[model samples]
Target: MHDLLFTVPGDEFPFTASVVVHVDGPRHVVRRTAGGDVHEVECTADDVDRVVDEALEALLAPIQVCRACGTPSASPDFTAVFERMHYICFHFEFEHGDADRDQACGLAGCPAG
Candidate 1:
């Protein structure tokens, strides 16, 4: 069990959570945070690598990126989740009004050229 804490961009409280991951043959038992968010996922042992990759992306700090026409932009907490035996990338953008959904490139300070 490891607690991953990410400093939120503000004077407010930071995002803190605990994640426990264990392998059980072709299944993984994941207990994230102490708020009772437990998940039992069915996946191949090979999927562990993918879980690690997703978890790393989720637990790490956020970096800037330019995914909209190669223009500098700020993004919210970057995270990836593996649920229902699938990997899904996510971000919490508090600003930037948009009526449509566009995927932002996972790069900080991508050149605008």
Candidate 2:
């Protein structure tokens, strides 16, 4: 069994929450705790990649503007990097800057926070 920690932006709140994904063979479980509330989902891991993708999409579904400049785009610039050491950096961008793209964007009032 393996586990990974991910930060997911809240939908109704302007804060980010930590999600723990537990993978055990063909079974995958996602858990989140916030504001004294705990949410979890258990499903058959038919496709691990697809499940992760869908979970990430649902986590950031409430974000409508760019994390950096608050620019609205139908298809915003989003990136996620997973390293061999189990480090994950996920964020959104509206414009390129001199900063590293593999780092998370800690923008206030943004989902990437």
Candidate 3:
């Protein structure tokens, strides 16, 4: 399970931005904070993939979604993976749900995550 938290300024409308994404196994809870308003989204899946590569890709998607909304972001630097701790970055890749075989980054020397 993973939970990602982000704080958006009290502006920027017409663009639905991603604020916080809470993951518990296959279920997802996406919460939004913008314009002094708060919204919650819930996604439920049957099970969470545990493969090393899939787990890594699953870890990066929310930040990618966030960066698409014009929020300030840092380069997609590699960060340590702590237990249940979240990563915040600007990198994105479409996994097709198969991180091991999908080479989305396309960069020769870059890591999958």
Best by TM-score: 2
Choose 1 or 2, whichever is better by TM-score: 2
What's the count of clashing pairs in each model shown? 1, 0, 0
TM-score of each: 0.33, 0.41, 0.30
Lowest-scoring 10 consecutive residues by lDDT in candidate 3?
82-91
lDDT digits (tens) for residues 15-109 of candidate 1: 35444566655566544442344433444666756765555334333333232232223334322221211112222232222423354344442
Q: Model 3, 70-105: lDDT tens per residue?
A: 443343532333222223222233322334543545
Clash tally for model 1? 1
Best by lDDT: 2
Ten contiguous residues with the weakest lDDT in model 2: 82-91
Model 3 accuracy (lDDT, Cα): 0.44
> Which residues of candidate 2, in runs, are more than 4 Å off?
8-15, 65-113
- After superposition, candidate 3 runs with Cα above 4 Å error: 9-18, 45-113
lDDT of 2 at 80: 32
Instruction: Give the Å shift of residue 38 in candidate 2.
Output: 2.7
Q: Could you tell me the lDDT of residue 112 within candidate 2?
A: 31
